[model samples]
Target: MVDNQSREMAATDPSAELVRLINGYQISQALHVAATLGVADHLKDGSQPSDTLARACSAHPASLYRLLRALAAVGVFHEAEGRRFSLTPLGTCLTGDALGSRLDYARWVGTPGMWQSWGNLLHGIRTGEGAAGFTCAVEAWTYRDQHPEERAVFDAAMTALSRAEARAVTEAYDFGHFGCTVDVGGGEGHLLKAILLACPDARGILFDQPQVAVTAEGVFASAGLTQRCQVAAGNFFQAVPGAGDAYIMKAVLHDWDEGDATEILRSCRRVMPATATLLAIERVVGPPNQDPSGKSFDLNMLVQYGALERTAQEFQVLLNSSGFDLVGVIPTYSPLSIIVGRPAPAA
Candidate 1:
């Protein structure tokens, strides 16, 4: 809810505030354009004249300057004397190689396919289906495969988000006790890499599609964990190879509807030993009338995958149906919660 003080400020100029809200997409579009032009990366050397920056980014000088002017008003850049602009702290985050960079993420979500898909939000609400009718994760992946550049952008965005969440998850969970851990649908193996780094004694398995596994292998070699971890490529809906003391799937199940989620869980369950444990890491939905990131994520799931972020009880039911008992939910510094489960005892 908007606080009363904030409401009062908006109330004083309701039309202006309402119009700003209505036109919020313009800011997003500006950010997308800036990121796509590599503006932050170009400014990394130092401030430059708008004409020079335009030449570097291969844009019309006058138009580039205008975009920077708008962005600077929003604190993304610093407009100096004589049409020179420099990267602000916020603008630096758009640098491709910057730590925690969101450049690719901005570009990815702003791509025409995604932009138009989100525009079809009403269709999803009315039909309970993606406007494009994506019925499974594979369809989306296949679409990405056909667009190599967009796929690369999407992959980089996932990598950035994984890096952002990895430290919080590793710090919150004690992986030291598990002899082995398997990261199902682990993209680029970042989470598993963090786990292995934290628990030096633990060997790990990173599983995903073959194309994704190639990248994960590189990540493992770069981390000097090639010997300690193995990369296995396959669909989770079919099977997840390599048994381990623990299995973890982060932000995976939320990409699926209940039937598909259960099938994926059952695939994991078949491989789980009686003593083995499972963890589903996701942002759990909160109560009614409360705004949480999960609520926004749920809408994203609806528009993208026809899925929903689950509550604790919803997760418990999913686990129970898959032959596991939900034990506890562990809090992380991130929005993600680790829903812990173990195989049920003989009936």
Candidate 2:
């Protein structure tokens, strides 16, 4: 779609694009500040002058005005007469209570620790491990547990992602065949709840760590699924509860490296009935030089968890080694792709 002149311009002046890329952090930080200060929420009713927002958010007026000016330049907000700022579509998404809001997500990603961890991305790449101790020895959850407020924000951000992606997954796969679908390591049971809603006749089991199971139980109860769904607590690396026509693990395996990931899968294999299916809902990395969401997320897994998003062939190999047969991948409406597997035949 590019015209020859546009192509020539890019070919001649790469500095402009490079500078834009370098300044990307400015935008991220701006959005983080907006989300933390609830700037979008403050302007929800209508446009307001920077002074009003500064007073409402308890921030310095001049500093807040400068921030808003920067954001408005980036199209996050629109500056109008009287120096009033109105939320643009992108800015509205920062409001805490907006549908599928990413406020907590912004705050969590922009946390000081997270920022420092990302700064060591070069070390992660050089050593093939997380330089900031974000890998298995000092997991991200360890940091979360130490910071309760940040943990809450992390949970909220996860819930937001689930709210956005769950329905797409529900539409992508048929749950009717399984009488009891167990969401292994499912936090708060959002995806399972969505599946149960879509397939009214199917039942669900929310399996997770004890703390997560407690929340899952409450979520199922609130969804009026108490009778149809149960909460089972266990350590996935050691064992998973032995029950279900199908087991679903979404965004779980990418948190661990191959050894740990295999161990977790083997635990499921040990408890899985021969007739059961294992559905791994994850982002499958594509070819090189392409800008796929999974590719960028792969880098995130690398620096944050020392994990890698696998190609379909890599997944096939992993599943084959973990006592499962690789069945094809089914792409969902979202970025995630479902890697279907079943128990391998007896040796």
lDDT leader = 1
Model 2 TM-score, 2 decimals = 0.93
Instruction: Show where candidate 2 strays beyond 4 Å.
Output: 1-12, 134-137
Residue 89 of model 2 has an lDDT of: 91
Clashes of each: 0, 0
What lDDT is obtained when candidate 2 is compared to the true structure? Answer: 0.87
How many residue pairs in model 1 have overlapping backbones? 0
Worst 10 residues of 1 by lDDT: 131-140
Clashing pairs in 2: none
Among these predictions, the greatest TM-score belongs to: 2
